[model samples]
Target: MEFDVKGKVKEYYGGIARKVNNGSGKSCCSGTSCCNEVSKTSLIYNGESLTYLPKEALEASLGCANPVVFAKLKEGETVLDLGSGGGINVLMAAKHVGTTGKVYGLDMTDEMLNLANSNKAKMGVTNVDFLKGYIEDIPLKDELVDVIMSNCVINLSEDKERALSEAYRVLKEGGRLAIADIITLKEVSTELRAEANMWCGCLGGTLTIAEYKSILENVGFKDIEIEVAHIYTKSIIENTYLKDKDLDDVANKLNLDEVDGAFAGAYIKARK
Candidate 1:
């Protein structure tokens, strides 16, 4: 039987949103959960930049890296954030675009959308809008956005090609794709691929940077580049992600060597 990759990812993120709503006072942990970015707001954002944003918005930012930094957003340009969580990036981008431009945050999970809307309200940014939708099938019309950005969310998509295609479709001619996400350096084992927990943790669906470039190119993107932020070494994987799981099963069958240097956080950029 095929694993329900989308189902697992949605459930995992939904749980995180519910936690924040319950006053857990914890940031959502998406990619590299607990290993790299959990509760480390300063690790992902600058202190001064976050001051005016909603406090809970900071708690709900579970992204692997900041994609807005890659966008080079211009005034009066519209932006769409795929899988926008907690509305932090949206709010920030709203400031970048000012009152003349708009930023749309698309999320499939209702809990996340609610939390994001709540954050939007707290921030009092009228230019920001949160929509309910999947990343693979964006809710916007074609050639409508000036920039497309996502933070650690596309890796969770069950259908990456379709997602990329939709991203291409929504982008105006020459629109940019500036995103921060997890990428693999090498192929993963079938055993590891079936690990539901790891998938929800943002490891299973990633493709190598080359694969990403190829897919983006095939989808009619140009000038593609991927900047590596950090590589997961052997010790980090073993000590962080590989702990507290059933070792007797197929997951144990994976060679630690195959896992090491296999994943990294990257800034993926391209033109549509």
Candidate 2:
């Protein structure tokens, strides 16, 4: 049977939203059954950076890095966050933009949008709006945004080129793209790439560093920079995505070292 990639991602993340809404206290990507507490600790925003947000927003954060820090948004500048999952980045961007600016959060999942709106209301942020839409087909006018930011969400896309093109179309002249996402340093085996669970976990669809830069360039983005923020080792993957499987057997079958050295969380910057 063929796998439905989009369906799988929606199901996986919708479940996460439900869990979080139920007061499970579970992190999105690093839930209790998937990753160890120590591994979960490795993925965090600076404490001071999150001081003003509600506790619900802090707990719902599922990003690998904080793109808001790198976005350098100024007062009165319009900003858009793609895949704005529980509105963590949206709320943070809202703080930076202040009352003069507006921050738009676009997400495909209804449950996530609901959760993000709830968080936005809890934070009493008047400058932010959460819109339900896919990143590949954003619901905004061309040249309307000064900056576009995404956190660990681009890799979840099935058609990354379309998504990047849409991002380019929506940005104003000289607008910036600041994103944090998973990228592969080397290639994974076909078997691993075929797994729906891996794709939903932000692993199956990663592009290599070179390929990512090439795609950004192809989409008319300039001055592209991709910096490795965290490397994912085989052990980490085991604890996070493959915890339920036979680790040793899976490792041997996948030639895990190549896969280990291949994947990392990266910070990507560019301009339209």
Candidate 3:
């Protein structure tokens, strides 16, 4: 089957939201892979209560790092989350921005939007709005947003350059972009790069560290800094793939020797 990147991302997240809402238990995919558990420790286990969200939302968290730590957000400001799945980050941003500021969650998945909306209501967050749109072309006014954040979502974009252009367009001058994503430390093999599974799971379709810096620079962003916040280990790899019985078999047959030496997670901050 031909892989439709956009459709696949939407479908994948929609399923996640559905599971979160219905409490039917999420299907075992790379989204819940053991790698994700290790990758999320810093974001969920540290500095905040994970009690605000359901298990599904926690399981759906795919971010490589936490953007809120570096966002340096101010009160009465407007913050936009590019891939606000389950509104976990959106809700967290709401707390930081306070009652004076507003938080916008833009996601392509209706199910995700529904789940986020429900969560917003449950939490009594009046300052947040869920937007149904693509990040490549944000449905917002220019120079209106003060900060932009995404968690492992930008890497899923079929056109990353276009997405960055949109981010720059909607942000005010000096507004910052703090993205937590899976960035390759070295070049990905041709075979791995071409795998559909890798892209959907936020692995195979990553850009090298230098390439990520170059794109931000070309997009007219200054004070750009891409740094490693965490590295995915083999133990994490085994855990993530273990959820999928079939994938576990293949994962064992093929030795992923290149897993640990290169870092798989990073945080990139830049200003427009």
| Best prediction by lDDT | 2
Which lDDT values do the candidates have, in the order given? Answer: 0.81, 0.81, 0.76
Candidate 3 segments whose C-alpha is farther than 4 A from its true place: 26-45, 52-56, 240-254
lDDT of 3 by residue, 54-139 (tens): 45556556565667767878888899999998887888888889999999999999998888888888788889999999999899
Cα misplacement distance, residue 78 of candidate 1 (Å): 0.4
Sorting all predicted structures by TM-score, with the top scorer first, yields: 2, 1, 3
**Alpha-carbon RMSD to native, per candidate:** 4.3, 3.8, 3.9
Flag clash pairs in model 1: none
lDDT of 1 by residue, 128-223 (tens): 899998888898999999999998888888778899999999999989999999999887888877777677666777888888988999989999
**Could you tell me which 10 consecutive residues in candidate 1 have the lowest summed lDDT?**
241-250
lDDT by residue (tens digit), candidate 2, 1-272: 27888888888777767766887655433435543322342356663346576666665567778788888999999999999878888998998999999999998888888899999888888999999889999999999999999988889888899999999999999999999999998767788888777777787889999889999999999999999988889777766544422233344446566677678999999998
lDDT for residue 7 in candidate 1, whole number 0-100: 78
Query: Which residue pairs show collisions in model 3?
Result: 33-240, 34-239, 34-240
Q: What would the TM-score be for candidate 1 when compared with the true structure?
A: 0.88
